[model samples]
Target: MVTRALIESVLTRARERSRLLTDSVDDGDLVAQHSPLMSPLVWDLAHIGNQEELWLVRDVGGREPVRVDIDALYDAFEHPRSTRPQLPLMDPAQARAYVRTVREKVWDVLDGHPLAGSPLAENGFAFGMIAQHEQQHDETMLATHQLRSGDAVLVAPETPDLGGTPEIDTEVVVPGGEFVMGTSVEPWALDNERPAHAVDVPSFGIDTFPVTNERYLAFMDDGGYERRELWSERGWSHRREAELAAPQFWEWDGKSWWRRRFGTMEPVRLREPVVHVSYFEAEAFARWAGKRLPTESEWEKAARWDPRSGRSRRYPWGDEDPDDTRANLGQRHLGPAVAGAYPAGASGLGVHQLIGDVWEWTSSDFLPYPGFSAFPYREYSDVFFGGDYKVLRGGSFGTDAVACRGTFRNWDHPIRRQIFSGFRCARDVQGEQA
Candidate 1:
């Protein structure tokens, strides 16, 4: 399955995503600090190259590093995001030239190497890893652009009006049963998602779509933010300390809501899944609505459940890879499509937008599965396994196809509201059926 074509396709995706990250902004914007939480765009530009060089060239191909002298400069672990700006980052052109130089050699490596000898190269995992890494940075860089001011530097055709969207809130019933929770077959699946295991989950009812902006706005309108009882002690304190009136980038103009998007201030899109909300916010909203965030297993079963086959799917819609018509991914459009937009992409139990829209927050704290082992490096997923972070399932609009899968797991600090995170509620059925 790890054909040369597949390897080249992954490389092309990485190149395309990198171009998208670097081409939109001027050199000044590349180094400018958009947020202390994010690295400079130029930093990401070179870091992507650095990762490729370390893995594809030095590690896999058994070649000397093209830029060993600058390796430490781009080591993400060495420089925290807050201090990255102060480091001696290469200029955008230098970074671009360096990556291009690295990539040219990487292609040569891909052309002649034996991809079967190692796990990293087997199944084109290393190429896919590099592609996924670059695409992830592309998402981060898009976040930077969203955080930056002045004027809208990015543009995408508005999300389609997928007309027959479900209205009047309803939940679908997922019968209690045993199901495969993660994956062992997916070639590019990350380590945390490894060693697929069986999970016995009770029957539950889950929202047909992600919690929409309109529904969340209703929570805010009804004093969801003011009521401490609805929030956890930590959540309430964080909300109070930060004074989160609404999701990040939102402003209630007293009359109605107005918010900033890529740089344009406009009314919030009502039907899209609420994005940039913290775990606390999601939990608070769930409390106000008298529901709960689904456990990681519950979320996966809902999205991947298949009655006929009694198995988990690779995506909400069965196993064929994502296409633009099927899912809104690969930064094809910046903002999420309207909720209930992709009927074809819904799961068998009628869950919509489960694949690409927003990273749905789950109730579970991130922990490793049974027989879990880190491959290549521990820094990727091993470092974040704890209560300090909450898991988010599904992928966002900015997520690329190569990086996302039904079992793909994303995690972040509970107080973070800057990333594209959202949630859908799940409730136990009154008379559960096993």
Candidate 2:
């Protein structure tokens, strides 16, 4: 059970992260649209506040609306990211003040409302939901910073070096069978990850670490982009249309490749997990390496299933929440840690970096599990369930612990590369039933 103190702590931590991310940039940067794929930082700032007010202050506490006039402006379904800039958004100062006011009101609700007796409030689920929502937006804002073209506006310490990279095996075998695939008990879990269900998976060999830049470079060096046979029909078509020769923000000088990260250009760190690649790119690379992207079930089994116990873990490292030692998460580092950097966080099958680094793309489409039901709303998960989007497991460096878990699901179009994404290869075990 969650305590009021824990809820307060998480809410405070989420707000602190939101403030740091937004304050890192100037007011001008906050209002500017860094990319059409993402909203202006100011819009996200106000939207975070608006959501808290709607869910907690009013809905949970039976309080009056806070700035009801601006509700439509911040309603995400009402406006797409491309058109958010055209709306009458609160400026940086006003956005700050607005969120502050909303937070004060939310605290009042938290103090008065019982933590049980309702689905939304049981175990402080609504408060946890709000915290997770804000953290998710904080990650979105970090992506916007990555898309912005300007001098470096954010600073973070480098991930701790594990002395030197460990000499770990390249891959591990998951002797998969039936494993629980989703959660019914995680209080803050969203609608899509509900009703934990059993999945029978065939044994498979999966990469021990996320595919590194060095490995991806080998694929590119072998004319991976020029070869169409390695790619699917639609993937090839999109590749040709976009002319995606490398991961996003990558440039080749006369001699070597360098990538721009949040305004600073640096040589590609070959040891780090390759980021900003689309599903098509990950797929083509997997084929080039004589393997395939793991199915969603395969990925989860590798990350969460422990054969000795015949059960699933809440995280690769166990039920405990993430910290700096476990994963390179919460934007503590500007980029992924070197591959094989987190041996302590390895799963039961010795899969390293499965919880955090870059979001690993899977071969499965985004679909609801059996016994799926939309709770509270439909737009959160219902509208996006289909083949139009591919499922991505795990979380990126920008993802926060509140918003990521063993069963947490993320998805995007096959052609999207701007988000922090990567992949690992898998192959069916020889002579084994899959």
Against the true structure, candidate 2 has what lDDT?
0.90
Worst 10 residues of 1 by lDDT: 161-170
What's the true lDDT of residue 233 in model 2? 98
Model 1, span 1-434: residue lDDT tens: 66889878877976887787678889888999989999999999999999999999999888988889888999988889999999988999899999999999898998898777888888778888888888888888888888887877787888876746578377888999899988998988889998889999989989988999999889988999999999999999999999988999998788988888888998998888899999999999998989999999999998898877898899888988888777888888888888878888988787888888898899899999999999879999898887599999888998988889898988989998778888899887879653
Show the colliding residue pairs in model 2: none
lDDT top scorer:
2
> What is the C-alpha lDDT profile of model 2 across 209-299, one tens digit per residue?
8999999999999999999999999999999999989999999998999999999999999899899999999999999999999999999
Report the alpha-carbon TM-score of model 1 versus the true structure.
Answer: 0.98
RMSD of each: 1.2, 1.4
Candidate 2 ranges beyond 4 A from true positions: 167-169, 432-434
Give TM-scores for every candidate, taking all chains together and pairing residue i with residue i.
Answer: 0.98, 0.98
